[model samples]
Target: MKRVVVGLSGGVDSSVAAYLLQEQGYEVIGLFMKNWHDDSVTISNECPWLEDSNDALLVAEKLGIPFQTVDLSEQYKERIVDYMFNEYEKGRTPNPDVLCNREIKFDVFMKIALSLGADYVATGHYCRKGILEKDGEEVYQLLAGVDGNKDQSYFLCQLSQEQLAKSLFPIGELTKPQVREIAARMELVTAEKKDSQGLCFIGKVRLPEFLQQQLQPKEGLIFEVDADSPVYHQEQPTFASQEEELAYLSKNIAYTPELGKVVGKHQGAHYFTIGQRKGLNVGGTKEPLFIIATDVTSNTIYTGQGNNHPGLFKKALFIQQPEVHWIREDLKLKAGEKMEVMARIRYRQPLQKATLFQFEDGMYVLFEEPQSAITEGQFVSWHIGEELVGSGVIS
Candidate 1:
């Protein structure tokens, strides 16, 4: 029997995953990942690591599988926590969940499992894997889960072909409700447990408080730019090439203190993100204000009056060549090539129609319609049908 290592995450999905793999006659071992230990910033009663680890152990015992816990806190801090601090410091938002799956789970944890003679590492992610034959070679495809509402293909967007080859997602074929039912029938400890929130391994945290631990608060001014500002009324320029036109469209609008009036003060510019609406503490506006831009260097945050503000929408976005990642290397676009694909800037966002243009320097994704708050340091994933072909960090 082939030996498989399952990352039992102390949740119904993972519990069911382990049980299903056992039913398939594979020799399964359960390993709960202890990636976070600092609970100072984590909220109370919010999927604490100790509770989660215990639940994972119970599930493994009930499944009659050998189980253990892997302490990956150090690796998680280096690969994920440090990166997040650096990104936020530079006024960019980073997705820790995506980084966690790529840097820790698939890379570090997979190596540990392989060292133990395991044939594959499995998780409870709501995404499917498919195999295709091309030129007598086996190709792995990262397909969306069968459950539309719970599809999590976006989180695994950075996974490489090699990682996908050794990975298994057992619960991808079932909906959330179906998985819950199966766990209930099996009388699993996590059967009625609520899903974990906030960070991947870290529980729900008071974000501002957490960031404050390292990123000390500095008072910053919040300026509210009007919807009819002259900044948004710039005349379109004729471009000599398509790349030139795209470069203009993809660029972020530079905000200045002179462009708007001071509305309020924020604890820190680094704590705010584009499209964020809460924590402003500024009231009495006709419509709620949303963050449109943040300049950490100047410690200034620019806000717009409403969601449909012009500053919030962009027609295109650029990705530096080094940041581009292709799961299906065979389908990668060459310089000067372009392809029509469905793409999303953030997780669970409805796929939007976009065209990817590859250049000598980088790639540009031009959407058919304007998209809101295309933040930097976030991943943009493109899909060809159900298969996620490529992803890149937004520039």
Candidate 2:
């Protein structure tokens, strides 16, 4: 029998994953990873690790599998928590889920499982993995799950080929409702439990509040662009000659000065992100105000009211570190090559059409239709049809 280690998060999805694997005649062992908890003294609704471990133990008992809890709290803090703080400090919007999967799930957890003599490690992630033959060599391909609403390929994009080869996702082919049905059939304790939300271990705490606990409040100003001040460039020009003039004006128009008007006084520029509207007190605007830019050096926040024009959204975005999982070794794609692809800017957003342009400095510029809220420090996942190609951190 093939020995498999299942990452049980004390949730219905993972519980069902272990159940299905055991039914397939695999020798399964349940492993719950204990990440971290906020120790700086604040009320948190985070999942108590003890409670989750107990729940996982109950599920393991029902499945007749050996269970063990690995305390990865230190690793989680170093890789995930510290990385999050550093990103926010740099005024970049970092995705903790990506780091969690790359550093913790695959790196730390996988190594631990392999050391225990398990042939493969499994998770409840809604992603499919399959081997493909390329140039007489077998390579792993990560595919989007069948459940469109619950597909988690975005978070799993940072996974390398080797990780995918030894990883198993038993629930990838099943929809959310189908998984729930199986959980109900098995009478798993977490069948009716609500899905986990917010940060990995922090549960349901609002991001801003959580940040306040870790970071010091530094006062900064928020700037709102004044309509009467000046029309730097108008999308529709009055005359043919003015069209050329408008183009030049648009190119030179500075967004930094405008952002300084709306953010009257903020704690810190790192505390906010582009496209955020809530908590911004740039009152007296008829339409809702959205954060268009942040000048960290000048300590300014820029706000734009009314609908964001298509031109304001850029078709191209640069990524700092691109991690690609190619099936073939010799498929060297050159820079400026326009390849048809799909991408997602945020976790919950739907995938959209894009073209990848490789840069000289190992970076990639994704050209797409003006995507809204293309904020720096966030992740952009790439896909070729239904298969995840690669992902990178927006620079």
User: Who wins the lDDT comparison?
Assistant: 1
The C-alpha TM-scores of every prediction are 0.99, 0.88
Query: Which residue pairs show collisions in model 1?
Result: none
Kindly give the stretch of ten consecutive residues in candidate 1 with the minimal lDDT sum: 36-45
For candidate 1, lDDT tens digit of each residue in 250-345? 998999999999999999999999999999999999999999999999999999998999989999999999999999999999999999999999
Off by over 4 Å in 2: 39-46, 226-254, 258-263, 306-312, 321-332, 363-368
- After best superposition, candidate 1 residue 244: deviation in angstroms? 0.8
**Top candidate when judged by TM-score against the true structure:** 1
**For candidate 1, what is the total of clashing residue pairs?**
0
Model 2 per-residue lDDT tens digits across residues 1-395: 99999999998889999999999999999999988666343235455666678889999998899999998989998988788888887777888888898899988999999999999999999989878887798878889899998899888878877888889999999999999999889888878877887677555656777777677778887777754444434574455643233233223135656323543678788888888888886677788777766766666777677557332365566654344434323343665444677888887688888766554444444455567777777878777778887777777
Clashes of each: 0, 16
lDDT of 1: 0.96
